[model samples]
Target: MLDGILAARPRGFSLAARYVAFALLASTLNLLVQMAVMGLYHGPWALLLAMAAGTAAGLAPKFLLDKYWIFYDRAPGRLRGLRQFILYGLLSVVTTLLFWAFEITFHWLGDGGPLRYVGAALGLGLGYWAKYHLDRHMVFGRA
Candidate 1:
């Protein structure tokens, strides 16, 4: 059963896993920067700004990784890399809006430092899902 389940899973999931890891690392770095330099903590505006920055930060590495490693297609005139970037940028905005919405909702929920971080995590995860699927198929696929 376990082997069957594993076999049934899409290979894109593995690629997505790597993409998520890299994005998380970038996001974490961005978050730390916002916290240390900007001194933002547990506020809706602060979280939104931090996440926006983090999303932008994540895009660079994510693009490189997805192009060279994850999708790994080598066609001289494909132009998918550049197209992927633009699509990903648009999707990133959607993700950012979703994250901001969640952050605002969480802020309305209550005041707890740890919970705020959890809210951030939730938002990041949501964005990651969209990015992974879109990158795997739309951005990288030949079809």
Candidate 2:
């Protein structure tokens, strides 16, 4: 059964799907951790603290999955990997800001919990779109 499942999986789809799936799994785990931290602290600083923690945790899986599965770039030296990591860090900042913007905007527009999720989803989707293109072309060298 496992062999059949593996054999039936389309190569490109599996690559793309797994990368995205791992990213989302990592992000969810990161966010849950962050939420726990936020609840523990219960203040404005909690949000920032959660974000930092979430970003740190989220980046590692994202980098590994993208490098090995999605882009399949040749292994570069430590410095190059670090440089790429820094770029991803910057991207994460942009994504976080966008997430907050969407959340706040949606809240102001009378959105509650579920709608907040919708806003977050929209922002996250946009962030991933940009990240995929940037990783494909710039980081991995021309898709």
Worst 10 residues of 2 by lDDT: 1-10
**The candidate that achieves the highest TM-score relative to the unseen native structure:** 2
Task: Write one digit per residue (lDDT tens) for candidate 1, span 86-132.
Answer: 88678667777776676657766767354655666787778777766
Which residue pairs collide in model 1, if any?
Answer: none
Give all candidates' CA lDDT scores.
Answer: 0.64, 0.67
Which residue pairs does candidate 2 place in steric collision?
Answer: none
Q: Report the Cα lDDT for residue 15, model 1.
A: 62
Model 1: worst 10 consecutive residues (lDDT sum): 2-11
For every model shown, what is its TM-score relative to the native structure?
Answer: 0.69, 0.74
Q: How many collisions per candidate? A: 0, 0
Q: Which numbered prediction scores highest in lDDT against the true structure? A: 2
